[model samples]
Target chain A: MKNLQIFCVIGSLFVLTACRKRLDSFLFNNDNSIIEYKLDSYGGELALDIPIDYLVPNNDIHLFEYQIEDEGEDLNISAIFVGDLNKISSDTVILYCHGNKDHMDHYWPRQKLLSHLGEQGRFGVLMFDYPGYGLSEGEPTEQNMYESTNGAMKWLKNNGLSDDRLVIYGYSLGSAPATKSVGDQSFVLSPSKLILEAPFASSSVMVQDASILNMPASYFVNTKIENAEQIKKCEVPFYWLHGINDDFLSIESHGRTVYKNHSESWKQKNEVPGANHSDVPTFMGLEVYSDSILSFITK
Target chain B: MVLVVGISACGPAKFVEPLKKFENAIAIDVGGPMVTIPDVASMPIPFSSITYGHGWSDKLTLHGSWYTTAAIFGVAQIGAGATYGVWKSKRQKHGISAMLGFNTAFDVYEKNFKFWPQLDAHYYFKYNYKGEQQEDLLTKNGRKRSNLLYVGVGTWYELEGVKAHGEKQQDIVVPMLNIGHDLNWKKWTLKTEVKLIAPFSSNENIVLDYVSLTGDKGSTGVYLGLIRKF
Candidate 1:
C-alpha cells in the first residue's frame, strides 16, 4: 500500500510536469505550426471610427489611457480610465483589473457603468491587457501579469498618481494578480479596495473540485493561492461578490472563504437569486451595483 | 516450421472415393499483361541471399535473409539475419504461414529497420486478413527510405497517413511477427507483418509489406502501400 501511494504521487508529479511543458510548448512554439489569427479580422486597415457607443463617464468622470512608467522591454500596458475626475477628492486610483479570455471590447458596458458614477469617475480607473491579450504583444503569464500591474502603479506614481489614489480591483481569475500586486500596505489604493468577483481559491482547488475531471485528492495537489489569508494583512476596504448560482467556480469557494477572513469587512454577496457567471451583470441590476460603487468611491 | 496436417485414413490401398480430393488448378489471368504495379520494372532487388536462422532462450536469436534487387534494383544480392528475429512480415509461394516465435526465433525476422540503400520489388496481397482492415488507403510504395515515392489506391491496414516510408521494420532490433490476410496473387506473393513492440512515438497500428521482387518505400510510408506479382 505504501508503495502504491508512492507510485501515485510520483505519477501525478510527472503528469503535472508534462502538462506544464505541453502548455508552455503550445504557447511559445509552433509545434502545432499554423497561424490562426486572421490579420483582417482584428481591426485591419479599415479607417478608424471612434465607437459611437464608446463609454462616457458622468460629470466628475475623466478617462485617461496611459502607459506604465517602465523602460523594460515587452511590459507595455494601457488603461481604460473611468470615474469622475473632478470629484476624486480621494487621491486613490482604482485599477480595475480584468480576467483572461476576451478583450476590452466586451467590457465596454462595465466601462460605461463606471462612468455612470459622476463622482466615482474622479477616482481614476486603470486596466490593461497582458501580452497576447487585446492589442498587447507576447503572451500572458501569472508572473508577468504581476510585474505588468506593478509597472502600471509605477507609471501612475511618476505621473502624479499616488498610493492614496490606488485601489486594486480584480474580478474572477484576475483576483490573483490584484491580490498579489498589493504588496504590504493598507489605507487606500493598495490592494486596499479588493472586490473579488466569483474568484477561484486556487488552480489546484479548482482542478480538484471540478466535476468533469478525474481529480485526485486535494492533499495530492500543491498550488499556491492563499488569497483570503494573504488579504488579512490588508488594512483597507475589502468587498466580496459571488452570484448565488455561480455554475462555474462555485460561489461557495469564492464567497465563504473570502468573507470569512474579515472581522469588519464591508462584504456584499448573493446568489443573484438565479444567476450564472455570464448573467451576473443583468441579475444584480446594473443601477444598484453602480450605486454601490458610487458610495464606495465617494466614501 | 509450417505444419501441413492432412486429415486422411492411414492405409496403403485407398478407397475408390478418396476422402481428400487433390485439387490442382492453375489460374493465369494475363490480359495482355495489363500494366503491372508501376515502378516494379524500375525497382532494384540487389542480391537474392539466404542466411541461416537460429533460436534463443530470450538472451538472443539467429536471423537469416536473402534478397536480390539485381539490375532492376541495382542490387545483386543481400543476405542478413540475426540470432533473434530481425523483425519482418512476408509471404511466399506454397500456403505455409508461421511467425518465427519470440525469445526463441530468428531476431532479424523484421524486414524494416534494415537501413539498406536498396529497394525490393513487392507483391502485395491483402484481403479478408480478418476484420475490417480495409480500404481508404492510398499509397505509393517506391522510395528508397525516409523518402517518398508515389501514392496509390486501396490499403492493407489502416496505417496510410504518412507521406513516405513503407512501414516500421525492426531490422536493427527483433523482426516482427506477422498475422494477416493472404494477398495471394499467382506465383508472386504479397504479405504484411506485425511487430510485438512498436516504437513508442507512433499512434497508429502499423504493418510492413514484403514484395517478392523489387519495390521501395511509399510516399504514404508504411501506413499504406501497393505490390504486384510477376
Candidate 2:
C-alpha cells in the first residue's frame, strides 16, 4: 500500500507534467463530461437490471442528444432526455443537475428511480448534458454549466415541459447550477420546489473544505459558486436533502451553512442519516425523495 | 485524515461522429479466422473508417478506428463514404497505396504530446470476400489492405479526472491529425497508418507511465481488425 501510494503520487505528477493541457478528444481519459442513460422502470438503486421485456432485442430506450451553441468554450453543453412524455406525466418535472467526477451515463440508474417516481407523481423528466460534458459544447466553468442548465430549462419548456410544476434537483456539482440558475434566460422559474441532495455550501467550499479537496479545498480552487447565497432569493419552496454520513461534502459545514442561510423564511430541510454525499438517490430510494418532492409540491 | 487533491492543468496543443447503415466491403485475414467464416455471427461487424490528406505528393497518410461489438451504444455504420475493399489478388496481402476518400469517424487521435506530435498506426488484411453479388474467381482466394490517417486540433476544450500535481483537473487544449490506407483485392482490404498526438503545450507529464517508472512521450497505438463486409 505504501508503494502504491508513492506510485500514485508519482503518477499524479506525470499526469500533470506530460501534457501541457487537456487530453485530446481522441484520447479516452481526456474527458470532462458524461452520457446519462436512465433505467426509469425501477424505484431505487437495487433493481438496476434491465427488465427482459425492455431488452427484447432491437427494443431499448433511445438516446436524444442536444448541443448548446455558446460563444464561450467553457459553455458548450450536451443533454439526454430519458423519460417519455406519452407514458408518464410527472406533474413535477425533475431537472437532474449531476456532479463533477463522472459523465451523464454514470447516473442512469439514479435517474431511473426518479423516472419511477415520475410514474408515481404523474410528472415528466428532463436531463441534459453539462457544457464540457459528453457531447455538449463549451469548456466547463460554474457559470457556463449554470447557463447550459438554464438553457435546458428553456428547452424543457419549449419541448412541452412547463416550469410551474418544475422541480430543481441538484446533486453534487449540479447544486451549483441549480442555485445559480434561478432567473437566467430561457428559465421558467415559478418552480414548484428545489431539491438539493447532498449539496455543498458552495463550489468553492466543496473544493476547499470537502474531502475531495485535499488542499484545504480553498488553496487551489479559484472558481467560487455560492449556492447558499442564492437559495434565499428563490421564489419557490427550497428543499434540502442530505446524506449525513457524506464524507466528501460535510453536511454540517456545507449543508447546514446553506440551510442556515435561509433566514427562517425558506421551505423545509430534510436529511437521511446514512446516505453519503453521492449516495442520496441510491441509498435513500426514489420513494423517499420523490415523496418529499410530492408533499412539497402538493401542499 | 489526508485528503487526495487532484489538480490537472495542461496546454493548448490537444483538442478534441456518427453511425449509419454502412454499405461496406472487406477482406478478413489477421483479426479473427484466416479462412472464410461460415456466416455473419461468425464474423465481426467491424465498423471503421479512414482518410487521405496532403494530396498524393506527401505520401503521408493517417488513420484510426474502433469497430464496436455493436452490442452496446447503437448499431450499423450508416452513411456515405463508408467502404470495405479487399487488397491484393492473393488469399492475404500487405503493402501500401494512396487514394482520395471521405469518411465519418466515431473515434479520435490526440495529437501533440508536450511538443512531440503523436501517431496511431492501424493494420488491416482481408482474407475473404463474403458478398452475395460479387463472388468471382477472386472470392476463392484474394486479400486487401488499406491505411487511413486524420489530424486536427481543439480550440476550447478540457478533460476530467486527470491528476496534476496531486490534484484533479477538468479541461485542456486538444489538437490532432490522422492518416490511414486502404488496400483492396478481390473482396479483401488492409488498412494502416499513424496519428500525431499532442496535449496541452504547457505541462509535460500528460503521458506518464508510473508502472514503468518512466516519463514517456505520447505514442501511436496500432489497431488490427478483420471483418466480412456484406
Candidate 3:
C-alpha cells in the first residue's frame, strides 16, 4: 500500500506534465522550420497545386515581417503578399489565414490558388505565419494567433486596403482568429465577408466528441475559441465550406453547428463530397471551389 | 460544479456474483469506447481504474474505484457501488445480480466537479468442472473452479438539465448493453467484457468515428479486468 501510494504520486506528477497547455499546444503544429518559402519547389507532401499560368511573377510576391505585442511579448510575424503590392488600393484582397500546420510555406500553394480566384492576379492574396510557426518568433498561443493575424490586417489597412475590399478566410485552426476578429470586433479592420473551411465548433465540442460526454473543455484545454457562439455576433455574410468526409473536424458537428448559429446574415454552405479536412480545396476541384468563392464575394 | 454536467460513469461492473461473506478483493480494469483516428484504424480509448471490494454478506458486496486515467489527465474521478444478488439457484447454476453506483470527478486545475449516477443488472450462468476435472482444478486452499458468462444492461444518468452551450440536454440517460466472461482461477479472476455504450445517442455528429454495431448510434467499449481475492 505504501508503494502504491508512492507510485500514484509519482505517476500523477508525470502525467500532469503531459496534461497542461493543451489548447495552445495541440492546436498549433508549427514546430517544423523551412529554410525559405519554396512554394511549388517545396517538394513536400502537399496535394494542392497552382497551375503554371496562374503562378505569380517573382516580383509580385513580397516577403516581409511585422511586429506585434502578444501578452507582453514582442513577436515578429512573417508574411507573404502575392500580387502587385501597389494594386492593394484598387483590388479586392483576400487575407488568407492558413491552417494550424507547418509555416507559411506549407500553405503557399493554397494561397497561390486563391490569387487566381476570378482571373490570374484578379485578387491580391496576403498570407502570414502565426508566431511559433515557420520563422515567426515566440511560442504558439490562442492570443498569439489572434494578434499575429491582426498584425497582417493592420498591415493591409496601412498599405491602402479598405474593409470593404478585405475578405477574411480561415481554414481549420485558422478559423479561431478569423471568427474572433469578425465576431468580437477586436481587429484593426472589419472584413467585408467571412469564410471558414472545416471550422470546429469549439474546444468543448472537441472534448465532448472525444469522450462522448458533455465534458468541459476547460478540463482538457484552456482555448476558448468558440466559433459557434462567436458566429452569432458576426453580422457579415458568412461563407462556410466543409468536406463531407472531414475526419479531423466533423462536418455535422463542427461545421454545421457554426453554420446553424450564424443568425445575423446571408450565410452559404458548400459540403463537398468525398473531401477530408486538408483536402477540401483539392477535392472540390480548384475551378469549382474558385467559382464558389467568386460568387459569394461578388454577391 | 463547472458548466458541463454528468459526463461519465464508473468503469466496469463491480460484481456479477456476490462474494462469500467476509471475502475481500482488489481489481484493476482498463478499457473504453473505440474511436477512429481519421486515416487510421479504429481503436479504444485507454481508460484505467483500480477497485477494492468487500463482501458484507453472502448476497451483497460493496466496492469503490479510483479512475487512474482520469487522474493522469488531472481529473480526480472516484466511484463507489454496491451489488446485491437478487436470485440464485445452485442446481440451475444461474443467478441474477443488481448494482447501484455513483461516480464523481473533479478537475484539479479549475477545481470543478461533476457527478453521475449509474445502475446495472446482469444474469450470469456458472459452469463448474466435473469429477476429475474439478479435482484437477481445485487449489491447495480448497478454492472452487468455475467459469461464468454474463449479459447485462447498464445506465449512467446525467443530472444536469442543460448542456454546455445552453442547449437542451436531450440525452439524460446513457444506456449500455454488455456481455462478458469471467474465468475464476485459484486466487485471481480474469474478466473480459464488450459493451455497446449509449446506444440511443447518435454517433454521427461527433468528431471521432466510433465503432458501433448499431449503424449510426452509440459506440463499442471493451474492458479487461484482473481481480485478486484475499
Candidate 4:
C-alpha cells in the first residue's frame, strides 16, 4: 500500500508535466510577413506582386489591420477585401476560410478564384489570417479561432455587410470555425449559406485518421471541432465540395459524413474526381469551380 | 497508471513476475499504465489487466494476461508467455521470458479499428530481502509476506494496423528498461512496475492527420496492480 502511494505521487508529477497546451499539430508556421513577388516586365509572364494586386485584376484590394481581445490579450488580425468597398452594401460577400497551412499568402490564388465566381466581380470576397497564421497574433486554438472569426464577421457587419448577403466558405481547417459559426446560435445573424471543402469530421476523427490508430483526440489535444454534430443544428443552405481522391480527409469519412448529417433542405455536394486535398481548384479548373460555386450561391 | 499507458500502445502491462519458484499457483492482477510525453510530464490513463499463471516445474512457468482500458479510448489485449528460471541464490534470482500477444483498439469519434501483434523478450533479476531468504517465509496461518525487487531489459516488436490511412501497418520496435516491486500478504499481492521504452527507429514521423504518434522518442511508463493468489 505504501508503494502504491509513492507510485501515485510519481504518476501525478508526470501528469502535470505532460499536460500543457499542445499547439504544434494545429499551427504549422509562425512567420508574420506575407511573401512578396515581382511581376516580369513582359506582359506574357505572370508574376505574383506584393500586397497581392496582380492576383485580382480590375478589383480594388483593401487591406485591413485590426485587433481583437482574446484571453485578455490583444491579437493582431489581418484581412483582405477584394472588389469595390462600396459594393459591400449591395453585393453578396463570401467569407473565405482557408485550410491549415503557412498563411494568407498561400491562399491568394484560391481567394482570387472565388472573387471571379458568378459574373466577374459580381460578388465580393473577404478573407483573413487566423491568430498565429500569417500576420495574425496569438496562438491558434478553438476558442481563439471562434473569437477571430467572430471578429471578422463583426467587422463585415459593421462595414455595411448584412447577414442575408453573407456567405461562409470554410476550406480544410477553416471548416471548424465556419461550421461552428452557424451552430453556435450566439452569433447575431447566420450566413446565407455554408461551404465546406475537404473538411474533416472532427478533431478526434482527424487524430484517428492521422495516426492511423484508434485513439481519441482528447488524449492529446483539447480542440473539439465537431463539424458533423454542429452541422445538424444549421439550417442554411450547405455546400460541400471534396476531392474524391482526397487523402487527408476522405470524402467517405469526413465530407460526405458532414453533408449527410446536415438536415438542411438546401444542400449540395460536389466530388471532384482526380483531385486530391490541395489541388481541388486546379483539378476542376478555375472556370468550372467558379461556375459551380456561382450556381450554388445563386440557387 | 502503467496499465493505461500500455493500453495506449496496445500492449500488456510490463510487470516483472516473481523470480522465486512456486508450485501449482494462480495469480490475478489489475492496475493502471502510464506513459511519458517528452517535455511534458508522464501521464497515466485508467487501465487494468488480469493475469493467470501456472507453474509446470520448479524452474518453468506458463502465464497469460488480458488487459484493457476505456478512459479516453477502448483497448483490449491478450498475451501468453513462458518464463524460465536461469539462476537462483539465497537472496537473488534471474529469469528469461518471451511473450506473444494481440491487441485491438477503437476510438469513440473516429470509429476506426486498430489491430496489432506484439512480441517481447526480456531478461530479469530479482533481489529478495533478508527475511525472504528463508526456506519457508510463511506464518503459522499459512500466510506469506515478503518484499521482492525486479530489474530487467526487454525488447518489444509490434506490427500495428492503422485503418485510418488505408490500413497502413506501422512497425514499432522499442527497447525498454523494466523495474518493479511485488509485496505479498496472505492471498493478496500488490505489484508495481515502471518501464521506459525508447522511440521507434524511423524519422518518417507517424502523422495520423492531426497528431504525430512517434514524435516523442523516449517514453516512460508505470504499471500498478493488485493480485490474488489461490
- Kindly provide the TM-score of model 4 when superposed on the true structure, using C-alpha atoms: 0.60
Q: Which segments of model 4 are wrong by more than 4 Å?
A: A1-30, A33-55, A210-214, B1-230
Q: State candidate 1's DockQ.
A: 0.01
The per-candidate TM-score of the B chain, in the order shown, comes to 0.21, 0.31, 0.90, 0.62
Could you tell me how far off, in angstroms, the CA of residue B75 lies in candidate 1 after the best superposition? 50
lDDT of 4 by residue, A183-299 (tens): 875664578799999887876555553333355565445567889789988999998989888766777668877888899788998899988877777777776877888988898
lDDT of 3 by residue, A53-93 (tens): 76778887899999999888788888999998899988789
**Which of 1 and 3 is the better model by lDDT?**
3
lDDT of 2 at B127: 32
B1-230: candidate 1 lDDT, tens digit per residue: 00010001000000100011221111111001011223344221111222223333331333323221111222222233222212223431112112221110111212112122211112223233322222224222431211111111111111122111111221222111212222333222232222111121221110112222112211111111122322
lDDT of 2 by residue, A116-165 (tens): 55353254556666666566665566556766776777667666665566
Q: DockQ, per-model, please?
A: 0.01, 0.01, 0.25, 0.07
Every candidate's TM-score, chain A alone: 0.69, 0.71, 0.92, 0.86
Candidate scoring better on DockQ of 2 and 4: 4
Worst 10 residues of 1 chain A by lDDT: A25-34
Candidate 4 or 3, higher DockQ: 3
RMSD of each: 21.0, 20.1, 4.4, 11.1
Kindly list the per-residue Cα lDDT of model 4 for residues B119-211, writing each as its tens digit.
Answer: 555555544444445636444333455555666665544454442323333435456566677776556667777665454432121222111
Mind listing the fnat for each candidate? 0.00, 0.00, 0.23, 0.03
Tens-digit per-residue lDDT, B1-230, candidate 3:
01111124335678888887999999999987776654556666677888888999999999988877777666777888999999998664889999998888777677778788889999998887442155654554536577789999998887887665665556678898999988887678899988888887776645457777887888888889999999
Where does candidate 1 stray beyond 4 Å?
A1-72, A83-92, A118-122, A183-189, A211-225, A263-266, B1-230
Residue A116 Cα positional deviation in candidate 4, in Å, after optimal superposition = 0.9
Top candidate by lDDT? 3
